[model samples]
Target: MPTYRAPRGTRDLLPTETPTWTRLERLAADLAARYGYRRIETPLFEQTDVFERGIGEVTDVVEKELFRLAPRTEESESWVLRPEPTAGIVRAYVQHGMRTWPQPVKVTQTGPMFRYDRPQAGRYRQFWQFDVEAIGDPGPAVDAEIIELGTRFYREAGLDGVEVLLNSIGDAACRPAYVAELTAYYEPHRVALPAIERGRLDRNVLRLLDSKDPAMAGLNANAPRMTERLCADCAEHFAAVRAHLDALGVGYRLEPGLVRGLDYYTRTAFEFYLVGREGQQQAIGGGGRYDGLVELLGGRPTPAIGFGIGLDRLILALTETAQAVPSEAGPTAVVVGADPDDTIARLRVVTQLRAAGVGSRAELGRRKLGKQLEAAARDGAHFAVILGDELADGNVGLRDLPAGTQKVVALADLAREIERAHAAHRHGGGPD
Candidate 1:
């Protein structure tokens, strides 16, 4: 027999790594809420059309990466693990009547998204994202705000090397002309086009600008730029977005070649990358304005802007750039030594400390008090509440591991004593 393993494109996040994920998730949720975005969760799988219709049938996620489900029995409509969150968020907005609540409803969600692609470094078949969206607002200020939100989030995570590469992709009002010019530029050299890119040249010309085929670099470079062809309104919107970002002191560079990966993006499209002094170009996250997506999913026409921060790639960059990925906070105290004969009374105090909002752990069995203290130290517990001698006198010995001091605390006042110990630590006296 062979050892079973995680399927291709997937890997386990073991206990040692999960605490970092928890810490990052808590920070992300807090940052999202501080920006006035409420958290919302949607089903992991949605009707396949939610993505196909929302992300467009010709896009890579729909054409190549979607994981469609097989029904247990016939007659159920098809479903797929979500390739992204925005479409499902839009569907939820329409289905739950959140439309009537308020204009520009801002929401955030964090979870796994599945895409069946051949994985590479920092790219997985299953990935997690922290998605933030603001619906029903058309202001360029909102677009800038979304960008600022993402920038500030990375800053909080202690990632100071990220730089924003930005561009305006125009919209239906002006994109048609740019696409026409783009098509004309390629039609003349159609015979020279790579077979994979030829079909999309007509239906999705903008995608050609994003082609990675080294052979087409020349053609893509010469293709008409979207910024030059933007309609009056689109150009003004892009300018305002730029102005607001400058006003906030968020540094960004204009990368006219950046078109982003989605079909719904318009006007403003940007990607955040870890820019090293040696020219590192690892992109951590990106998103853009999708002003037409709401109506496409059955809700009234609404304008929206959002970005999904890739949790996996961000951590990878953290490791690469040597940024700190915080771990879960350590336990406040641990009960040291074997349980007393009156087990219920001794253990009850530990439970009571926990119920009263303290991080507490207990040691079981006849481990020597020495070994028990070692376990408490390994557990990162600040205080070792030793169950010894004083139990008969309704007192326990409290040892401060970091400061190396001890005190006799009344068993009835265990929680308070733990608090006093920490307070002492804060005030410089410590356990001494």
Candidate 2:
């Protein structure tokens, strides 16, 4: 016999871990909705061009991380599981005839994403994210609003001190000259550069600066800062974004060399890192102003900005909060039957209770009544509706685990009785 396993780089999120994910997503959705952002969903797999065109064909995501699928037919273009949600969201924005809607159409989404990257701690091939996009409008104010909103998500999750590392790669007007300067600075030390990084230097020079490679650290640190070379318009936009964040009292550090690897990011690029992660900064989420993305993907010349929050790391950071709080983990009752032949009837009762909006578990075994009751208690079940020969009397035994008490309630009154017992339990009247 062999043990079947979930494919590498993926793991199941079991029932016990779901409450945390739910609470985090609910908070994100509520916060996004409060900002007038509506929920939007896109296909899990899309034409490869959706990402290739949006994020740039040379980027790591498209070059190496993509999980491309074979074309179903010759007429069909290739598809890939979404490595990130932004491209799909933007495609939806264009394909769904959103042009007639209000300007800067704000949308938020949370779902799984696939990336065939090496699995490490806090990184997975299949992961989930909370994504937000402000399409059709571009303003420093909205940029600040998005950054503040990202920070607020952490606060709402009961974790704070998330520091924002922000920078400006400038726009087309200034980035070209800056990239030339960056390339020149690195080209001299090309021998010192790792072969992989040297490849990025000639093509996307800024990517080398964003590298985590130990060898390139010195080259990047000594390179020129794009902030010093920003066009007047970009400079003003950056200033206004900072001013808006200041007005909102959001804290952020200006990192001149910090640039998102994605090519679409323009002017403002930022990442949110856990400041208190034991002195190690781990980015939880980040986004930037991509003013040219909408137009590049065939839409009218529209400006947009958005962010993607990594949910796996987020849940890890907020796990303690979930533990401290009491949540409705599982069902409150288990309909346990004493007779082996009572399985169907027991299940029927379970269904009836559930249909009436009372959640419960079902144990349809002929195990001893005491053993079934003990299992229910171990699961923290508040009630156990024990069915037996006495069920013929139009009554069922309802035992309150906390109170160590039991009562025979009429079948017709079972739902009402369960509600009353649970309410009492909530009101602190049930036994400890």
Candidate 3:
């Protein structure tokens, strides 16, 4: 028998590393809520057609990265491990009639997104995404607000050195013309294009504009710029979005070639990158306006714009910048030295602490007092309540590990004193 590890490209978020994820998720959810976005959870899997139609046929996500599953029984239907939540969320909106309730329904979600990608550094087969989507409104203000929300999320999470690169892909009114021009531009250089670039020339012309191969860079440079070909309405919408961003003091660089790798996106397309990270894969978070996503999923043509911040990549950037900090693990009050004779008394105290919303764990393994304290420290506990033969006599010992302070208090008042200390610590009152 051999010790097995996590499957390649997958990782186990152990206790020590869980705080980072927890803090990031909490910050994202809080920011989303502050922006009037409610939380919505969808299934881990959805119908295969939803992604195929929504993500675009020529995109790499659909053409290569999707995880398709066949039914076990003959009569069962086909399903796919959802590659993204936007399509499923749109499906739910249509199926449940969210359109009738209000205009511009704001929603956010945080979960694992499965993709059959070739696992590499900063890329995983199963990764978590904190996604936020605004449905129904087509106003440029909505786009600006979503981008601002994403900026706030990263700032709050302490992910510095991020830059927002923005662009407008125009709307259906102007995209077709640009496609034709782009196709013609690449026609002459078709022989010089990479295999993937050549394959995408007819089916997905926009992708050719962003090919990473050195040979295709020259061809891309000569291609038409999307901003110049924007329709009147799209041009006005994009101008308004830029104006709003300027008014709010949100810094962004105009990226003419930033037609995000998705079909549903229209008008505004933006990506937030961590500067000085790995080349090309420096994107920590990105999103854009998807005005036709809802309709594609069978709903009314509701407009939406949202972003999914990559938790892993953001943490990696934090690490690279040496800005990563150990998030405060919530207080864990340890009950030490539980004797068999006074087990009931010790259990009662533990239950009381827990009932009061304090995370109190009892020493069930019958370890020595020194070992118990060590265990508490290892578990990131700030304080330990020693309940031995001496303390069992109406008094409890409160050991503050960081301060090297010990005090004896009445058993009835122990929980209150510990809570007050925890509160003060939480409010930045103590040395540690």
Candidate 4:
């Protein structure tokens, strides 16, 4: 016989960990609903081209991190586990004709996203994300709205002091000239740069600006900034986004080199980082305007913007800060079978109490009353219902675990008595 375990880069979320995951997902869904964003779910896998075309083949996600799958049949299209939701959601929008619904079709989704990258402290190959997208809108107001929504998510999640790093990468109209200037600046020092980064500079010069390579730091710091060369329209859009944030009282820093690692992103770009954790693996979520993605993905020229918060990273950050969702209340009452003959009576009481909205459970393993009560207390049960020979007289023992006190109550009044005790406890009356 051989033992098995979860594969590398993935871990099972056991019972002890799932409650927090559930709370976070619930919070994400609630916030999305409150923000008027409808939920949308795309397939777990999509045509490989959807990503290659949408995220750009030159980007790391496509070139190195995509978990590509083989064609199922000879005629089937190449497929891969979705690395991100935006591409798939946009694909759905195009395939389902969501454009006919309304302008700026806002939608949200939360699920697992796969990436074939090296796993780190907070990064995983198969991790969860809370994604939001506002399609068919080009105005800077929606841009600001998306950014504010991200901020609100963190604030409501009890994460304080998250700062916004904002920038403008300009659109196709003004970005080419800036890229040319940036290329010229870095061309002289090409020999000193790493081979991979040197190739990146030639292919996607903007990425080098946000590179983590310490050697390239000084060189990139002096590179031409797109914000300084933004076309009039882009500059105005950036300023408008800033004004919207200012009016909303959302503070931010202007990071000229903040070109998000996506080819489709244009105009405004932003990322949310813990105040002191900036410049580290502390960026929990970020996205920007993908004005060219729709057209690139076979849809008409539609402007859209969205962001994705890495749930795993977010949770890790929260844990590091000593913040967490409060532990949930456990079973309110446990129905213990004092003897084999009490099984039916115990089950009946458990069902009735549950139907009456009490979180009750029955010990069905034929354990002795003492053992059953011990298990109940370990499970955080507030009270224990002992079923024994008293059933003949329609009576039972209701033991308050926390208070270490037991009382006799009629069988029919067990549920009501439990409710009354709960109310009394809530009102500062000790367990009766």
**Per-model TM-score versus the true fold:** 0.91, 0.91, 0.91, 0.95
TM-score result, candidate 2: 0.91
Q: Candidate 3: which stretches are off by over 4 Å? A: 1-3, 328-332, 338-345, 377-380, 421-428
Over 71-170, each residue of candidate 4 has an lDDT whose tens digit, in order, gives 7699988999999999999999999998898888999999999999998778788999999999999979999888999999999998888889999999
Question: Which ranges in model 2 have alpha carbons more than 4 Å from their true place?
Answer: 1-3, 192-197, 211-222, 276-281, 319-328, 338-340, 388-392, 429-432
Where is the poorest 10-residue window by lDDT in model 2? 320-329
What digit string (tens of lDDT, one per residue) describes model 2 on residues 221-283?
877889888999999999999999999999999987687878899999999998757532288
User: How much lDDT does each candidate structure score?
Assistant: 0.85, 0.86, 0.84, 0.88
Clashing pairs in 4: none
Best by TM-score: 4
lDDT for model 3, please: 0.84
- Runs in model 1 deviating more than 4 A are 194-203, 212-215, 277-281, 325-328, 338-346, 355-357, 427-432
Worst 10 residues of 3 by lDDT: 337-346
> What local lDDT score does residue 378 receive in model 1, on the 0 to 100 scale?
78
Ranking by TM-score: 4, 3, 2, 1
Question: Compared with the true structure, what per-residue lDDT tens digits does model 3 show for residues 1-432?
Answer: 549978778899877677777888888888899989999999999888889998988788899989889789998767888888888888888899999978788999999998998898789988888999988888799888899888888888887778999999988899999999989988887787778888888778887777778887776787799999999999999999999999999999998878788788999999998777667569988998889888888877788888888888887777667666665664568787646345566677788888878888876665667887888877778888888666647888888877779898788887788889888886996544
Q: What is the Å distance of residue 397 in model 4 from its true position?
A: 1.2
Per-prediction CA RMSD (Å): 2.8, 2.7, 2.5, 2.2
